[model samples]
Target: MSDRPKTPTLDRVHLPSDLKALSDAELHRVADELRAETISAVSETGGHLGAGLGVVELTVAIHSVFDTPRDRLIWDVSHQCYPHKILTGRRDRIRTLRQKDGLSGFTKRSESPYDPFGAAHSSTSISAALGFAMARELGGAPDPALGDAIAVIGDGAMSAGMAYEAMNNAGHLGKRLIVILNDNEMSIAPPVGAMSSYLSRLYAEGPFQELKAAAKGAVSLLPPPFQEGARRAKEMLKGMAVGGTLFEELGFSYIGPLDGHDLDQLLSVLRTVKARATGPILIHAVTKKGKGYGPAEQAADRGHGVSKFDMITGEQKKAPSNAPSYTKVFAQSLTEEAERDDRVVAVTAAMPDGTGLDLFAERFPRRCFDVGIAEQHGVTFAAGLAAGGMKPFAAIYSTFLQRGYDQVVHDVAIQRLPVRFAIDRAGLVGADGATHAGSYDIAYLSNLPGFTVMAAADEAELKHMVATAVAHDAGPIAFRFPRGEGVGVEMPERGEVLEIGKGRVVREGSGVAILSFGARLKEVMEAVEALGARGISPTVADARFAKPLDRELILRLAAEHEALITIEEGAVGGFGSHVAQLLAEEGVFDSGLKYRSMTLPDIFIDQASPGDMYAVAGLNAGDIEAKVLQALGVERLESRRA
Candidate 1:
């Protein structure tokens, strides 16, 4: 530990109001302090570090210029909001970030008034800000004196259609809104698309700034009668040359490729924009992803997000575990499969590294497609690839896939395309919290007409599931796995494609049957062992497929067992719900069966360790055992050995 106070400058300010009190030079000092605090805080807790570091100065400048609670600062994807959190009354609680009953990793509206619009998914800031902007006008509070709506979005997020949709609306409406395009030249991975190239060019040339000023200067010099005509001509010339050609066509006054790291320059540019009179203006601020921290700066992905590490050495603190991560297992399996089948290709929505497709990309660069933060596009694009007789695996986080739900349903599922969805982080993602938790995918996808949803209980099962997904050609198939390492199970040398909709009995018992789905089966197994020690034998079955429920196996369990408990790593409407519906249809409840559906409770679970979060949700071994005992209507056992 350095002698310097933890979050020194950040600790002093409690709200955006406090930030508004600082001078330009003081704000710069505050930004430096904020960067140090953010880096240190993330180093301790382990979270999205590089993005937050990159936006430290921007965070300070924005809060200083805007009245947050009133102005509504909507962060596109709150991955970069650690500094925002520190400045806005969360400095002390910063260390508790992503822990259960602690601060959320993303901007949450319910968490604070300062975070007007909460976002975990990318490309939503512009839409959210536009909503706030429209609401402000409709509420009869349109006066510039009141406040303005601003959206700080990343260039990577800009690749999504929603960002463009919001930009289109904002431009056409000519609303008094400011959109600060925080171009870090990266999302999780390096950005893709023509827009990315365009932004990069603009940042390098600085033509947008020169042209805007010259156009204004030229218009001002024209005689009174010719002024309007010159203004129109200048607009035309600008449309031809620079003046927000993309945004202007959509209806915005585009400004800058400003240096986001330069505090004075940022403050000056922001102040100028704040003073300007008309329409939606976009200030493009070019920033390096990992600005202050050397270790993060040197990292290939700019320490995008990290585990806890040594502050001085920047070496991650390793928690000794025998198992590999589900991500690693998936990557290994996919790479192995691709090696065998050259037709297999991988795609990610600006999250190649996060989804563990980076290894595959390295091995087969020509086959990997990084579609930027455009999940919808990525899904449809994969559908296109699949249509062309290629095995396109759309690797995306479970939470992010929600953005492409329509595309999945209409483009792939309806069309019966074989788009393999490698859904990573399918359950409660710890530090990132609700924004990143893949709680809804199971329920949502299960409801889809032709969707195949599978959950891996362990590393070996994940390999089998990967093989199964690759082999399936009937329709879309999705396999979900948790965030952390897999259980210490021996990995198979070669994956075996299991029969779809078929489940296997892991443990044989008579009194109770626990239909475990996904990785939560480990907890179910533990509960079973505990129950056995208490002279209460329970059967454990791994329901490999959530959508195509194993009716035969489930029916057999219902007929034989005293009670059936369905456990999944998702929310209410998913596997548990499907199981309940099946039992109800089969008249399994006619005998008045004792049943309990264990799913994530209907609330946004906060950031915590995965184990802690699961414990809170009563999905841990102890919790599972307790729930089973309660369902059995039995008193607490003194000892499992009894």
Candidate 2:
């Protein structure tokens, strides 16, 4: 018997206009049903749960008060937009979330009219909103695209520098924009719901409120003083520490630390702002993540990401792993190295659990640093730690490390600081799509002057590389490993520091040579086996270092083989490109040596399983065999005879 909550009120709401007809009490009922629906849909599909639950009333309030699609509502990162999707005419297809050729997990403009801007990455909403806000004021309103822009960003996301940069700009612009600071973490501004509203009302009518800086566009709708003993009241509120001084300093009229779950308060403030707000205003609504769901509320990260689960029991049905994940290998190996060296330390940008640094933190809490979502600052902070003689392993996702690239070059590479980068998610991630794909790190990091880059073929190799990074203090080094469970290879009793800039020959062959970088080594071997039955035995070698170019091994392979094929799970300018450059310099290509480089094509692939995505890329075992046969100018039909 499915205990799915009956949504009589929600069934009437097909769009935002339908929401406006409902009373405040009825709207609360709608939010409750919506929350139940969100949990139920996610239980079937397995996606982001806690974030959506936290913002149910806020989503309801915004849609009811403001004209969406006209009044642009941008969800920062959009991890919490499941409920927003439910409200904004997407409830029917909500069960198809994160599926192949179905609705995306994050906010996409193509998904619906209500999703004004696409966002999977954090700290980008404010900038996008400002652009829309500016366009609206400048008479550049396009059909169904322009209106008052509202960016709903979380407290963790605000820790990034870009959010402040956008806030600084939004403050200067003074466009009729709204920023709802969804402080679920309660890291910034304590929860004092009534006190927050009282102070906000008084502050809006303070002595500073009357002075409208029209030149800078800092003007409030509230003209002057409001009531009897107002000055004394303002002084008392100030003493109570109930004002949003940080946002106010940025030139936006700030409001609320109100109860986001309270429909009455939410509706009241939103209606007032929609009618009378002159410039940028930030509504600080403090709500608990996983607000209604008991299991989600109890768990850390508030059930942020999930697998398909039973709605009744709140138990996830994740597929059991045969081996440890690459993330765990890196964390465990780094912890092992830390046991040997007292100077060793680890850093992560707010994803301690995701990166497996929570285990490290448990063992050595003093050494493990969770720097919040400030990747740029995390990179530089690691650099500073390195300069001061501590060996800092900055563990960040390869996609996110792009945020701190300039810092990587200027702070670590230029100065020659030995900051070890343990890059997780080094290839296409499944449902998160192109935005979270770790496809560019190899190309980006390898081009730097003194940087050394390595990609682990499997979990065991990842352990060795962790050891290698710990021993190598000469300059900056990075080692990347893919997501999900590693191939069940035999575990080494202890890690051994591998020699720098070397390649290991995995198998011996004669007709052709297949040089591989990264986790594609396993696929290369499978291709070799498929080729073996056709009498085309190919030499296989793992090029450990992409930058330094395993000179002796590559040259020997190039000299002996009739054809050479290089493969990597990265874009064009990555490991294979470096191999091509090395071969060209050595005049290997001059001899008309049949050479091919397999790289990810110049296209952004959408959400699919990693296996399905790789199939789309044509880097599978069969794809590799076909490439080899073509390179050798041997017909597949003819090769079978030999």
Q: How many backbone clashes does candidate 1 have?
A: 7
TM-score attained by model 1: 0.92
Question: What would the per-residue lDDT of candidate 2 be over residues 1-642, giving only the tens digit for each residue?
Answer: 256678999999999899889988889899999999999999988988888999999999999999988988999999999999988889899988987776889999887988889998788999999998888877786676576889999877777789989999999988788999887762221222332344345335433332211111212233455423443454455445434367778987766556678777778778878887888998877688888999888776788898898887889999988999999999999999899999999999877887899899999999998777778989999999999999999999999999999999999999999999999999888888888989999999999999999999999999999999999999999999999999999989788899999989999989799999999888998988888898889899999889788999999998999999999999989998888898889899888788999988889888888888888888888899999999988786677888
Please, what are the lDDT tens digits per residue for candidate 1 over residues 348-373? Answer: 99888788999999999999999888
| TM-score for all models, in order of appearance | 0.92, 0.92
Candidate 1 differs from the real structure by a C-alpha RMSD in angstroms, to one decimal, of: 3.5
lDDT for 253 (candidate 1): 67
Candidate 2 residue spans exceeding 4 A from truth:
1-5, 186-232, 239-244, 636-642
For candidate 1, the per-residue lDDT at 615 reads: 77
